[model samples]
Target: MFFKLQSLALIFLGFNAYASPLAEPNEVHISERGAGLNSFLNLLLSYLPAIDTSVTDATGIITDFDNLLGALTGAQETYNELGRSCTEWTVIFARGTAEPGNVGVLVGPPLFDALDDKFGSSAITIQGVNDYSASVQGYLAGGDSNGSAEMARQIRAAKSQCPHTKLIASGYSQGCQIVHKAIAQLDSATASWISSVLLFGDPLKGQALNSVPSSRVFTACHALDDICKNGILIGPSHLTYAVDVVNAVNFAAAH
Candidate 1:
């Protein structure tokens, strides 16, 4: 949430730098600014191990690799398409605190794009909660009441409108608090409509997600993520959830 100007700029610029050769015009852009050089270095390092071990021919790198990076790139945009029509999946994602747009840039859009690549664009519908302010004050209150209600409203509608769709609830940072609040507001039967839950940098990290079973939920909290820990210490670790996209995607996709 507190991304320094230089760090945020460098994170995306580095991606653009390396990806530019393989990417088309505006093809290698990042949506929202993210945590600075650490995020860039982490992503770079992830590929390094793979490159050293398996990628003998760099030219042989395939579209899947590009697709993965592309998924994490986008413009700050708000979408409210979930439950618009019955589809294979309905994904409702909330952006982190103070993040712009409904879905936010850091994690929501990337997750949407990644899922789209996996199951085709038409196979799923993704929506972000634009009605919520995503304010820090709201997070301190254990999530804004209005935001929680709005998210709950979407959950109710998604299930009623598309009974068979696999409804997934996901959020990052304070967004995770909203998910917990919204689900708690619902009755057991209604809450059970959610197929899976994915949370990153959760403030309520170790706590149960009310009616949602632990088996169906996955919370990605880095050891250094202060938000996920006991005390309040907002470090760069809290903002680097972009690193967990692959694992988050796999968990949501499987369930």
Candidate 2:
């Protein structure tokens, strides 16, 4: 029992290892995780290859084990709501540093599920910021230039193509830095399309979101979340932001 808890603790605690800040991120690091835990994560993800997010069932809530794992592992990584008959809202998300997949496993999936459950799948589109690597060096350097540019391009494309969807830009950890940089790249016209901005464990917490109004933005920095103060701790507090999803979602929906 202790082993299980310790294993999870290690996974979160291993994040923000300053010693190897420049190494490329791989599943938070393929070698850093034990073989047993790796196998367990793989098996857990295999049962539900597609998160089926953005299309909630009659129950309208994610309750299954595999389904919940889907949210944790970023199974909704493929959810892109563009090119559909209608898109009332569009969410462009950047995952944390070292997290696997474009959306990352930690925060992206749960956010997708919450938006889906609240707004209904048909009303929203969630797109992962695939253009960025979410690299460690990028986090240490404030933000990756290329990643920031790519995210801005995506935000512009989403709003330009749909022309009607309310845009939401979101990020976690290093992803938050990219969000900050990306927003800076936007012109006044493109910036106005952003209906809401969500930042979790933001490294640039106090810094304003260039053109986005404070009333339309929601930032969550849990107690002891060193990242909020520009520290890269990635502590247990950082992992607990999932608990704030309901409030964050409500905040987003309001805008």
Full-model lDDT, candidate 2: 0.66
lDDT of 2 by residue, 1-255 (tens): 123556545543442131122121221222322333344334433332222222112111212332334433436444555555548888888887766567765577667767776787778877777767666677888988887997898898887788888888999888899999999999978886799998888988878887788888899887566778887444445544554555678898898
Worst 10 residues of 1 by lDDT: 48-57
> What's each prediction's clash count?
1, 0
Runs in model 2 lying further than 4 Å from the true structure? 1-74, 83-85
Q: Report, for every candidate in turn, its global Cα lDDT versus the true structure.
A: 0.67, 0.66
- Residue pairs with colliding backbones in model 2 are none
Every candidate's CA RMSD:
11.8, 12.7
- Compute each candidate's TM-score over C-alphas: 0.71, 0.71
The most accurate candidate by TM-score is 1
Candidate 1 residues 78-181, lDDT tens each?
78896477999888888777666687765776566567656777998888876898776777787778888899999998888998999889898788989988
